[model samples]
Target: MPVDSKLTASSEKLIPEKQIAGKLLAHYDRHARTLPWRAPPGANATDPYRVWLSEIMLQQTTVAAVIPYFQKFTTRWPDVSALAAADEAELMAAWAGLGYYARARNLIACARAVVRDHDGAFPPDADTLRSLPGVGAYTSAAISAIAFGRRAVAVDANVERVVARLFAIDTPLPGGRREIDAAADGITPDARAGDFTQAMMDLGATICTSRKPACGICPLREDCAAFRTADPAAFPVKAAKKAKPHRTGHAWWIENGGDVWLERRPDKGLLGGMRGVPTSVWRVAGGGEGDSPPDYPFAGRWTALSDPVVHIFTHFSLALTVHTVRAERDCMAGRDGEWWPKADLASAGLPTLFGKVAAAAMREELPCP
Candidate 1:
């Protein structure tokens, strides 16, 4: 049934908030995403620990990628105390392939903080949750609303998009975030806020997507101003993307009989706390970076692979030219690194970029003699 509904606080016309909340909640009751970290819609209470963990993992990562990781982490560390007590190296290894390595570091810090500062239980309010490590505006709001059922407006990327389209806010993001936040606040109901926020997220994820929103069957179709317009996807206007800078570096690969020398990255900058092949400083490509490899970790005969290992990060793309060294077992004595058996390289906690370099450094690709 179509009914006039209030979508934002400052809209010109009058529409009922109850109408919007009722329809959205009804839709959520019928079609909610069954995620590992989520409880049933009307369960007594959701585990705040799981909520916090999932929210942390889901930052800048997709649900599909997070599912297996979430399952593995939950299986290994069943509770907050367990995670707080887990080994940093083991945790970083488990978090190997997941980009944004800083999140993993923050995860450990947040867990420890929760245990030490809050007595192993997550505080229920947004303000208190914000005090914990790595729990920012969006994260704290999500924890509060989803875990505690507070009326905190949790506007993640999905919720932001949904709110932007619901009201047809044509303002570009960053600049328009204030308006979007206000509109999200307006739509958040006084009751069942957790369900309401989750419903909005579901609506954005499943129906009102970035491309070709399913306006015909959307639960809020009647109330959506963008749906009334032909091109609903364009409502959430985004700023133009600037080109990512490019960087080039050299990696030193030392392979003995069947073992490889791996170095742990310094615990400060990019890919920190992960074990990977030794590498030289990364400099911007073409800015004095020539086709020739300039430096090596040790003085030895090195064979540089013709092709470079290319990996993209949020801010830049990297091209690491791998140079392999055939050396004796003790040749890596000067370098503070470990010699791991090639067969167990999978267990090594190499970041994705380094993993690519490692693959290129392997001798397995050649045909058997």
Candidate 2:
């Protein structure tokens, strides 16, 4: 079968599709990474639930970072139905420190969607998988090919780099992404599409790395255009990045008796649906911490700590001023969130930003048991 016509027109490079797939597959049989979500070489595919879960957890996250989380999630929820039935707050808590709060939200939505719309079975077709929550083009393709053995083009960051180098496409990223997609379609084989996609991923991760690709040992080196140029690392040119805008906010540590007041952020924006200490709105500043601190709901004499809690997000950098105040039980009456025991703050599942604030407060004031 021919490649996607729309992408074909934009493709900057063409290769021997069958030969490339065969070489990569042969290499994969001997060196496939022993990941929990994947089947061993020549084995039948693993569970779709495992494929779906691992793909979600791996988004913008590294394998080293995701392994423990994946194990924890599978151990706790087991399957789509169990995940669908999980309490939202508890699930969000379990996902704390995972970063990318939106993915956690979509994880819930996607699990519920799989159970509700597809009868707890993920759809086998890539296009159909795209309809599920959090399953975008790359993710849908990965799941369809890897889990369901469907013929689909899966182009992730790793695959993108490998293809960019193999073809030596010079167009910088974003603009070149379409060309990469087309090139990927050109190489994806009809049989063993899952294994082929995975081989490309493994090749890119272990060999075609960004900075210093090990071209001498790479299985595809002979077929690689950039390798002929002797500078495989120079391919996949990227546009320069702009400086991330700075933002400032204040996290209030309202401790009463032995407990602290914490609230769930609104479920529509950053850090949504997670338990955290009360925080003022986060706004972009030209530079430096913004003019002054935001006011809190409860009234008390506030003690502002000197060191700020700093965190870097995708689009912005944030510096939160930490404030602490002891309050009477009545002062927090009718508040919107729960008063978590200060000693068991670890169980509160605070997002990283708020967790930092809590740590800062505890360091200077009360130490947990």
Each candidate's number of clashing pairs is 0, 0
RMSD (Cα, Å) of model 2: 5.3
For candidate 2, the lDDT comes to 0.87
Q: What does candidate 1's lDDT look like per residue over 1-369, in tens digits?
A: 234444444343544466788899998999999999888886758999899989999998999999999999999999999999999999999999987788889999999998999899999999999988889999999889899999898888898899888889999987999999998888788899788878888888899888888888898887888888878888799999999999988988888877889888887799988899888888887777365555876677778788989999988999988888777877878778899888898889888988888888784342221
What's the true lDDT of residue 88 in model 1? Answer: 94
Q: What is the C-alpha local distance difference test score of each model?
A: 0.86, 0.87
- Shift in Å, residue 98, candidate 2: 0.6
Give the lowest summed-lDDT range of ten residues in model 1.
Answer: 1-10
Model 1: per-residue Cα lDDT at residue 12:
33
Best by lDDT: 2
